[model samples]
Target: MGETTQHFVLLLLCLSGLVHSSAAFVFWTAVVDISYYNNITNDTEENFCECGVYGQNARVETTSGIVVLPRDDPKGCHPDTVYNWTSSPWIALVKRGSCNFSEKIIAAVEQGASGVVVYNADGTGNSTSHMSHPEAAGVVAIMIGNIQGMEIVKLVNNGTDVYMTIDVGSPHGPWITSYWLYFLSLAFFIVTTASIAYFVFISANRLYNLRMHKRSERKLRSEAKKAIGRLQVRNLKRDDEITNSEAHMCAVCIEAYKVGDVVTVLTCDHIFHKACIEPWLLERRTCPMCKCDILKALGVEEESKDSITTTLPQDATVITVAGGDSLFEVPLTEPVRSDPERQQHRYDNRAFEGDTEGRE
Candidate 1:
């Protein structure tokens, strides 16, 4: 399996084990009720109290019988210990210590005892503990406090016919105990921390990608500026065909060229007013007439050779007008200006002059 799947499986197994262990630790209380004849008062007295807890491996059910104590040993430690009671149903009352709880329960079960009640050691008072008697399965066994057990023993020894009933009570463990709140709080904390951490990771990744995209756009715009500087610029004269023809107009500004007009020739052989097209090229990096990428055409940016073909006709030629003379020739294949400061100055002057004339 993959590493993530393995970790999930391991976590599930651990949780399952924890639940099983917690269940094992859980124990049920026993509602112990006793009735006897009060000889001095000449009346029957009964007492009911939830003062006992069932053993881990004992049967959690109701059982009633006369309370009987072992004749030889109160702890029921000896395997041969016997009971003197001749009743049809009886529950053995044993003391703590001297032997394991399983042994005491087993001794009582072998002697026809319907149930077993084990009391805690001395000085423990009314506080009882959950008992474990794995070896004595299927027997109804519970543990009562020393004080309660001693009271029942005294009544039985005084020749009073004391009848006891043990009933299953409520279950108690980590889920219902004081630890429950702490466990729930810990789980909530873990879930909240994981959610916050995942959200932060996603947000950081998106921010990083956005920053990278903006940086790339700025770099491409810078490259487009460099490519625009290398394009050819010419000053139009009155004798030029473009200045005389009404059909020829700059795409940007949508006006026919005039005498002394400065224009930039694009790689696609389409020309536009230098002032209008420079800003357009810097922002869009493409010819307005044919939508051709100037950066790719001028080799300033990398693109496939097959995709760089311009839309201009095969017979197209560059036009240059100087001193009222028009000359048709192949477009400039070399860089127009090599020095950065000279190129920037020339481009700025030509754009300023063109703008000034357009306004008038």
Candidate 2:
């Protein structure tokens, strides 16, 4: 797959994992309803509230039983704690402290309790948190506020029987109740849009560059054809110097010239068979022997003079005197005269003199 496709697939996998983890954090709220006989009014009184959260591993179902507190250790943290109630359907009420929620829930489950209610710690007026009790599964477990638990504990202590019903309420998760969900969604949208835009830009730039390169190549080939037509062509005769000698040969075909053969001469004065050199010049646009560009030589194409400068070796140019005697050498660009009394300047001064006369 392409790199973009791989990145999109990876992004989808991360989104799927995030959704699954968010679902795991989701938990159900509990609706706790308690009813008891009020001795002052001689009537049955009922109080209900959806202020409870179920444990992570607990069964999310309805269960009703008589509320029962531990006779010893109200937190129900002890392994040997017992309940005085002798009933088949009894809910254990324990304070939140001293141990994990699993220990308290397991203690009640072992004692024939159908459900467990754990209250929040002291000073936490009516706030309850979701409990995690993986070791105590299958049983209905919920956590209520501290003030609510104290009211039921006081009723049971006053010899009043309290019947409690626990029912599953609404589900709550981080995505539903947290502000970070909006921030994450916005960030993901911005990243996805920027990636798509960048990919499109890169593809368009590559296509544009390729088209420009091909257009330039076709234009250069057309100009080379024009330059070839302007070169010198000749028909060899029997008495020609090339046909009479065996030393000269066509560079393209590597064959000696014969009488009545047609040939073309390039700007560098290198001659080759017309048929052989035409195709070679069309492709390379340069002489095979001297590497001379026909387009620049015939004025078919203009090139920068500064960019076409010749480079020479570090050694100076050697000069030969009239009698074949050696004399001082001088650099080509900057010539220096060794003797001020010389008869005439040995180096050619026509180029410099012409520039001076033109200015005058």
Candidate 3:
């Protein structure tokens, strides 16, 4: 039993990890404003695909913040070197390196950056790696592909003042569905083989037990039959009230209990139809007249004292809230019921607060 439980726990952990990891690996895109360093006065700023360009140079601004670089060198900071970001509160533009994208973001954050915009450090074209900063609290980070990064790097190399507004969306990575399938297959194989082996071991142990103590086995079987018979008798006695409750009528709706309809058989064995008691419980979990284990029937151990009131019966048309557990009651009059379509339209327009209240 303990070994079986351990295997179940292992299966659950693997399944949970697979789900979270797969969700994290979905494709994500980042949108940001790119300013070229060469064309400072022209301000030919535009949105570019982060994955499309290399060596991208970009700046981020808060309502009030300053750009600080490592070495306290305010000017001529090389965006390509990851070492340059250890200085101050400036946007650290780093080139893509062999390190994971997360590692680059951490390096920049360590230097006290308000945000980090990682562009392609390489010459040109698109590139992506799983680069994210683990401790990036209140700091934004973006990874643009090589091509776009390079254009920004050029603008910076030309001494252009680059600034950007970045909007980061979802994470991008490999599909983990196959890994999930693999995990499930492995779990199935383990469980199947374990079950077969366990069955064989149990059969062998039982055979040994029977051979060693045949008389004891006969006595045990006889005692087990007597215990089971006693349990059946006790259960039969307890079921007498339920059998006798067939004639009870719901006090609230004044309707006779229907056969095959589920009933909230009370502790007192006073059976009430489920539909009749459902609204009553929603308003109050206690039995309508005799307050008893109504909530227990609903599987609720604790309940608030507040009882929700059911809408007073309307002629018959009711609007149901989508996905909501409660049923709404709307009265339908004869004139409105004559044309079902018109009645429904009126109900929709009224409930939705649309124009054409009475003008329909």
Best by lDDT: 1
Ranking 1 against 3 by TM-score, winner: 1
Q: For residues 1-360, could you state the per-residue lDDT of candidate 2 as single tens digits?
A: 243333343345446786565667777789999999999999999999999999989998899999999998999998778988997799999999999999999988899899999999999998998788888887899999999999999999999999999997765666553244345555667898999999999999979866765666567678888888888888987756667544445655656678998988777556779999899887667665445667888888633222333453443344322211323232222222345234124432221233235447
- Badly placed stretches (over 4 Å) of model 1 are 1-18, 177-360
C-alpha lDDT score of every prediction, in listed order: 0.76, 0.75, 0.45
How many Å off is the CA of 92 in candidate 1? 0.5
Displacement of the residue 53 alpha carbon in candidate 1, Å: 0.4
Question: TM-scores, in order shown?
Answer: 0.45, 0.45, 0.32
All-Cα superposition RMSD per candidate? 16.4, 14.9, 28.1
Off by over 4 Å in 3: 1-18, 36-44, 50-89, 98-103, 121-124, 132-139, 170-360
TM-score of 1: 0.45
What tens-digit string does per-residue lDDT give for candidate 3 at 1-360? 243443354346546774465544443355556543334365455554434211122222221122223343212133333334343345656565556555555565565666666655565457665444444434566566767666666656555556655554322346434454456557867998999999999999989766656554444344433332222111212223322332333455544334354555443333455556555544444444334434444343332222222343334443332212333333222222345456445433221122123225
User: What's the distance in Å from true for residue 250, model 1?
Assistant: 80
Could you tell which candidate, 2 or 3, scores higher by TM-score? 2
Model 1's alpha-carbon lDDT is: 0.76
